[model samples]
Target chain A: MNITKVLDAKGLACPMPIVKTKKAINEIESGQILEIHATDKGAKNDLTAWANSGGHELIKHEEENDVFKFWIKKG
Target chain B: MTDKKKTTIVLFSGDYDKAMAAYIIANGAAAYDHEVTIFHTFWGLNALRKDENIPVEKGFMEKMFAKMMPRGADKMGLSNMNFAGFGPKMIKDVMKKHNAIPLPQLIEMAQEQDVKLVACTMTMDLLGLKQEELIDNIEYAGVAAYLADAEDGNVNLFI
Candidate 1:
């Protein structure tokens, strides 16, 4: 079973959150899930674009308490 | 498989607008899955500084003119373009308000995306800049370094 890891990127700006998330996802095996929490409005688009471009799958994304959440699966 | 494309941007303009334009292009390229690098030399280094505290113009005339124009980095006033008098200042103010990435953050992102950053040793030597003067995490290299990266890619832009 693959573990779901959480990445908190709140209060972080563009590129930081994305950069960290990319690093985290890189360490995960295929089908493993990494959840990213961020505040930048650009992250939704940025992460989605990154995932698609890099062959990762975006499983879920949401916003709560002004934080944007994304669940991405490593390819 | 389609060959992954990359780009190299040589930033020579010290004007705020030009720097901002380079950032926009860099960001776009990154979003599109292209590896991007930005080389700051001469005046271009000012835009990357973290201590920049220039104010965002709020006066009526400045506001009016800003609204009627491209505003910010998009309006850099290169000499050939005279009507673009307020380009530099406008770019600075917009960058300030938008919290545009500081040089440090920009370097961090470029590294994260595997974008190579090369500080022009020739220019640095000419400007009397020491390695300590630059932000941490930047690779100090000469034109040969930039050429190495540029040669491997198809996109080469001199901003």
Candidate 2:
């Protein structure tokens, strides 16, 4: 999948990662994909809820070496 | 009619942690494209005060209240484990270490996101707080305005 922007939110705590993701998602065009890398465990659930509420699609997500990565397509 | 979701928060506490929680939720809701409003009342008004003292004429009681209350969000104490005002410093340290955005910046972020910051006019009068004592770019209103926004709100909270 094509990624329009990459957001590095590692090391940030609750709300920061989500805040940054929201801002990052706005910068990209609708229907484009935004990739986010975060270390916060809460980001997984929070990002999923955020994407769902914002009408975005979380197309893919995976955890590797304690890092959580997500690809969300703006809706 | 617009279909945008709305989140209205009534901030009634003066504690640092409580204010931070309110702002965090406000900023987060705003990020989710929800129309957000934080109504500052009573002790919560301290979060909107200016750090520097402004030379505004006031009565004796007003002056006393002003002297006792915190001047700004940064000066407010924590709701728990305050330890005679040392808790805020410890929390600040932890927040810095975790790279979390501080309360002031969170407030600024809310402003940037166009979240409506409203100061309760009735509370201001009761507390002897003048408009000059608070920060700029915030709306002044009573409970009526708050209800108008909250009646159609998707989420309403009192913190």
Candidate 3:
């Protein structure tokens, strides 16, 4: 069974959220989802580029009241 | 994907001229198609500040000392480094004379090349600086944050 993990990356900046999300994703099997909660505005762009470069799937990315949520489905 | 190598540079040199070597190297790496991330820390963090002054060598002896020194900025480590203490102002002047582009322009070029410039948050707090005090349009992060991005196949180095 695939597992999903929610990584609270809020308050983390730039590369941190991306790095932590990647680590969390690595702990799971392929096809699992790693949900990253980040606050840095740069993540909106940086994460997308990172996911693309790493060959992972970014399933969803949304912002709610200054909080950013990114869902990555591990490859 | 072609599996191009990724690299992360940790800059801790605060001396103006010394820090330039890292900035130059980071941009050079990206220019060659390598993905680059620079985590500015400690004295190195000043290089990212918008209002930070480019230090100058004072007095005749200080100037003579600078002229005789190897570029300390490049000494931050790793190979392919050397500098004469003329410092960042002199370095900038020399580059400008050669039409080598300005630091701000270089920064823009780095961004255009997708180089990641990460300002260290802890250093910022210790210095009592605000995010607005840094160069416009760069990102900020803690050590854990930088390590995360650097964890996957990126050549990590302390510059």
In candidate 2, position B92 carries an lDDT of 99
Candidate 2 lDDT by residue in tens digits, B14-116: 9999999999999989988899999999999999999999999899999999999999999999989999999999999989998888999888989999999
Candidate 3 per-residue lDDT, tens place, A1-75, comes to 233888998775433465556557768878888888888788788778877867788889899989998888888
DockQ of each: 0.15, 0.78, 0.02
lDDT, model 2: 0.94
Fill in the DockQ of model 3: 0.02
lDDT of 2 at B39: 99
Docking quality category of candidate 2 according to DockQ thresholds: medium
Clashes of each: 3, 0, 7
Best by TM-score: 2
C-alpha root-mean-square deviation, each candidate: 9.9, 1.0, 14.8
Score residue B15 of candidate 2 by CA lDDT: 96
Q: What share of the true interface contacts does candidate 3 keep?
A: 0.00
State how far residue A55 of model 3 sits from its true place (Å).
20
What tens digits encode model 3's per-residue C-alpha lDDT throughout B1-63?
556777788888665445555666666555334678988887676566654433543566544
TM-score of each: 0.58, 0.97, 0.48
Worst 10 residues of 3 chain A by lDDT: A13-22
Best by lDDT: 2
Clashes of 1: 3
Cα lDDT tens digits for candidate 1, B26-132: 76566556777778776555434334223453566534533443222333354333354754455445556755564334545555666656677777555444455
